[model samples]
Target: MSDKEELYCIPSRYRKTENLHIVFWLVKDLCWVMLWKPLGLIMIIPTLGAALLITWQTRAIKSELLHNVAVVFWITANAYWMLSEFYSTDDSLRYYAVIPFSLGIITIGYYYLGLFSKKVR
Candidate 1:
């Protein structure tokens, strides 16, 4: 750390929401791990909703926005995977979780590439 180093700060309100979002996400996953089908199914609402809100709030910050958007996709994939396990008559739908998972990877890749390009200039 140095005096010349740049600092990035998020508003307390946003931070609080982000913290609460973690709780929601954890609860969702815990429900999944515990195999509480009905409660787990319902937890996706707040989990995904908070991810969306975080993405929207950080839209002005390109790097943050990119990461947050990926989080949204991650949650989507997680929820889909959980649902597949819960509602499936067979074990096939879980394989499709790759779709959203891949999207999250691509989003992160794009962010790193963009950062690298900026440094190259």
Candidate 2:
């Protein structure tokens, strides 16, 4: 598909998401908190906390961009978590929780990146 078409196209599930664009934007607000949580002593609890925050932000946002980011993050995290838990038996198990939380960081990072990415500047 053409880039323009891809940009304009809306999915059936996201038709309702447009109303939440601002709340979705708020997900970026927790980037530092997410990063610090993983490094703290009680890692598992922080991991769960990050996941819950992302889940909450996804539900709170109405924008298609935010929805897409949230859905993609959720799917990727769950897949990795399941694979690590069932398929791998290594020291990297903590990543199953950490990587998912990283998505929120990425989402926030994107907001800043995209701000400069626009040609109008």
Candidate 3:
């Protein structure tokens, strides 16, 4: 990173929310692992909400925005996958998580393509 880029600072309040977001995501996944269907499903609300909030907070920086948007897609896919298994619908629905997973991949790919391109400014 350049000197200017290295100087970029994330506000403390936003950083706190980002950290909280991780906690919520972990709780959601843990509930899923323990097969606590009710709490696991409920946890999706806060987990996804936090991800959305983080994505919004980082909207000003292209790299951060792209990565955050990918995270939103990831949580969405994860939530859907978890719900599918919880409902015993995995046979027909789990694979659908690929949609959002692929979206996340595409977003990252777009970010990298722009970053690596040799186009003149």
Candidate 4:
């Protein structure tokens, strides 16, 4: 087995799909941020789709469990932020949105630090 396959255990095909999904996800977020008013939050649709695809790709590899969970948390965070942006009339929902957002960030950081930071031995 190749070194990467030994570490990640995911097929190259799924890895490529995951990489593409991540790229699309970032682009979607960029669009959402740049055109928030003019796009009227429509970018979330594609972002959500990309997030879902990423989560799905993570499912094939057991080593990616934490990353999968982080992606799920990210999706929840995005949902909360979207709700706060489009539907909330009070400050409470906006405040609530921060919880998931922070958790998502922490979890993503944990996943990267715990997994990606380790050198192959």
Candidate 2's C-alpha runs over 4 A off are 1-62, 94-97, 108-121
Clashing pairs in 1: none
lDDT per residue, candidate 3, 12-76, as tens digits? 99999999999999999999999999999999999999889989989999999999999999999
Q: After superposition, how far is residue 84 of candidate 4 from its true place, in Å?
A: 1.8
* lDDT by residue for model 2 (26-49), tens: 333243245333322233333434
Our model 4 lands, by Cα RMSD against the true structure, at 5.3
Give each model a TM-score.
Answer: 0.96, 0.35, 0.91, 0.55
**What is the lDDT, from 0 to 100, of the residue 2 in candidate 3?**
71
Candidate 1: deviation at residue 37, Å?
0.9
RMSD of each: 0.9, 12.1, 2.0, 5.3
Candidate 3 Cα outliers beyond 4 Å, as residue runs? 1-5, 118-121
Q: lDDT for every model?
A: 0.95, 0.50, 0.93, 0.64
Q: In what order do the candidates fall by TM-score, top score first?
A: 1, 3, 4, 2
Please name the candidate that would achieve the greatest lDDT relative to the true structure.
1
lDDT of 1 by residue, 18-74 (tens): 999999999999999999999998999999999999999999999999999999989
If both were scored by TM-score, which would come out higher, candidate 1 or candidate 4? 1
Candidate 1: deviation at residue 16, Å? 0.6
